[model samples]
Target: MSVNSESVAKKIKELPHIFVILFCVIVLSAIATYIIPAGQYTRVMDEGIKRMVIDPTSFRYIPNTPVGPFAMFVAIELGLIEAANITFLIFAAFSCLYLMEKTGAVDASIALMVNKTKKNPKFSIGLIVVLMIILAVWGSTGTLSYEEIIAFAPIFVALSIALGYDAITGVAISVVPVGIGFASATVNPFTIGVAQTIAELPVFSGLGYRCAVLVVMTTFTIVYVMRYASMVKKDPSKSLVSGIDYSDFTIDDARMSTPFTFQRKLSMLTLFVGVCVMGYGLIFLKWYINQVAAIFMIVSVIVGIINRWSANRIANTLCEGLSKGVLAALIVGVARGILVVITQGNILDTIIHSCVGVLQHLSLHVSAIGMLVFQNLLNFLIPSGSGQAAVSMPIMTPIADLIHMNRQIAVLIFQFGDGFSNLLWPTSFMVIVCAMVRIPLSRYYRWIIPFYAICFLLQAAFILGAVAINYGPF
Candidate 1:
């Protein structure tokens, strides 16, 4: 079915277990606060409820302060902000998709690319992998924005349709490769740059090692996704929505009537150049002049008007895109609320202290493993890799030093825990992207488990080997 033909809103509602999972998390977090006494588990339960309610900004600006019951409420508020960011980006991206659809640019682009790769699917896949590798390598220079997912998603969808693949397959092909790149990032400004800077490592100091890890992780992710996609293609009945004939969603009809005008082509070209320039500014120039969304929004408007799009049409498209974003933002916002509540109850600190305390008793070798597992568990609570790094790194680094563990190894542990679970985490942006494309979380989990298991083991083994040789930045 076409995106325009169906009520996307209704589809979102019909998805099973989504709300149940969300509600359960919130309720469980609340219960945790009640069960863990404030005195016993300061990290897990914040007794100082007054601080949180009295000042919401305190939680945003000041780290390590106990907020109590107010933590739940504040978490919800911050969760809203995070949601807003996602919403804004999604809306903007969707707007571009809608316009491209209406104008036929998307179809034309896909048809052109498909014809070139029609004879060899392997070549097409290789091309995608190569591009991801290039993007990952340049990502650290501050040139890559996670927002590329937004720009390329519809293209992936269109290409999959052209290639006689399921829509979910298209989403997977586009997202998983980029995800692998992001996860195994050699240069991702957001993930690696932010993380390494926080860890006090020289900028891009470990490029060679990270690049190697990136290749390993990317290869594993690609093989698994491709295999799962091929299975789904052969057996549509395997899908949750087996009755849906996604093949009818043609890129040709969408583009046939929309002539490729000079202005339209120019606008599209400008967007391409703009994104490249934005990447350069972010990495090499160290420019943070605008959030990636803002940059795209401004460029989109300028291009829209230049292509002679009517004012009303532009406004309508913008609104539609923004509405989708708002929905995503709400989910994120609510999730963040749970985090805030847990923080306020002072349970967060208690939990951290307790975990570290347990590690204190373990032998040095065992302590490293303990730290790895502990960081992974902590990932559920703090989803952002950079945010988690800021909070956990300082504390964990000192502990590593005491045990004669390499600080670099400690950081690697943090990266592994933070990056690997992103494929599975409901709270993660990648998961949100999958939801946007109508890929069921349950199905995604099934497709991804083998890949995740393999990568996790490989990463763990790599870390242990490094520790064994005392080859570390510490």
Candidate 2:
């Protein structure tokens, strides 16, 4: 073990922890603000989209708005402020989770699921596919944001391990479907909704084609995950985290026989009712995190009462859950800081403008592909779906028109670009979810590389097919 050999070996195995990785990207992004020239486009309000949209013809070179080194430090606080809704909801959701866990409801549910998986393994496999589809529906049609999956990640991971599979299998069933759904967004308000409205196409007008895409991608993802799960189950050594302890997740006959008591059932019902109320408000009242957070607070109190917990006991349990999630939630804010730096420097438009310059020279085929690749890269800088839409779509819409590409196809390209690398990118929810479930980003990346490669192939076919068929009525 000479010094050089040891260094080489260390390089082979060592990747920075997730926080260090995100912070390094942040510093680099802040530095980029000084290097990349700052520029701007006029943002006039559009009544239809109900937001300020870029005026493509109004692009102009502006004086640099570089964030100072001290300002870069300040942006972390600003980033948390900008991301307050998500950060607050993280606390609320975790509190509710802890409230449920204390009442024996959480273990009872897992115990029951394990019992069923033992009796009917094939049915359990089918259940994975079904679960992915359900999540995809929520992601595709509604405003399912990244960190929103926090409530379900642990449960699914525990369930997957209990079923003799691995942690990645749990993510495959839970997070991957949502990511794919976002990539193939059929009616997602954040991506399609904003993009379509900006393009002046009817909102959700191309539902039929998008739904077909959702089906194809969803099917492929299910097969990919199932194959992996089957392999890991048969040879436990193949599991990425095979050496990991899952003390809280594993169960035995005594645990399996844990009674489904009446109090536990009521606790579960109370939580379900809270979710139902949130859904109603989301669809009809157009609610977001603020509304969802309020509902969870109410639910936690009811859950405490239903289980006959003293007020102090309820408070303690709620705080316990909140403590478990601070790391995960702060990751979201730290990631948000990267976007804040980019925004503070006013370099976001400059980045988009520079890419558009390169794109303008390519042939129609290459231009379409370029847009997809560019969007994927840009997501590293701007992780907010609607925010990306607001910034990118106005520029892209005219690009579509100039090249005789359908606006719908342009929208699809943006959708694919914005979503496919979500979990792969350190700045996105992938880091948060991986942290929450105790999976290392490097290991998760190894597992996901193949999945992302196949996803790109699928994206290429769908984008090209849409071009061939002129995938639009408008």
For model 1 the local lDDT of residue 332 reads 59
Score residue 405 of candidate 2 by CA lDDT.
95
Could you give candidate 2's per-residue lDDT for residues 54-130 as a string of tens digits? 99988777898888889988888888888888988989988888778778898888888778887887878888888
Q: What's the TM for model 1?
A: 0.82
The lDDT, on a scale of 0 to 1, for candidate 2 is 0.85
Report lDDT per candidate: 0.63, 0.85
Backbone clash pairs for candidate 2 read none
- My TM-score estimates for the predictions, one after another, are 0.82, 0.95
Q: Which stretches of candidate 1 lie over 4 Å from their true place?
A: 1-17, 39-78, 119-123, 135-151, 189-200, 233-241, 245-261, 285-290
Tens-digit lDDT string for candidate 1 (1-474): 776657785566454655456657766777787665443321221132111111111222222444444555566677677556655666666666566555556566666666667767676667655655565455323345345564565567667766656666676666666555666666666555555565567655666767678777766656765675567667766654445545535566535345566776777786787677777666667655245666677766777777688988877777775655554445656766667667666577567766877987888778877887888788888886656765676567677778888777777777777767766666666556555555666666666776677877887887787688775542
The alpha-carbon lDDT assigned to residue 427 of candidate 1 equals 65
lDDT top scorer: 2
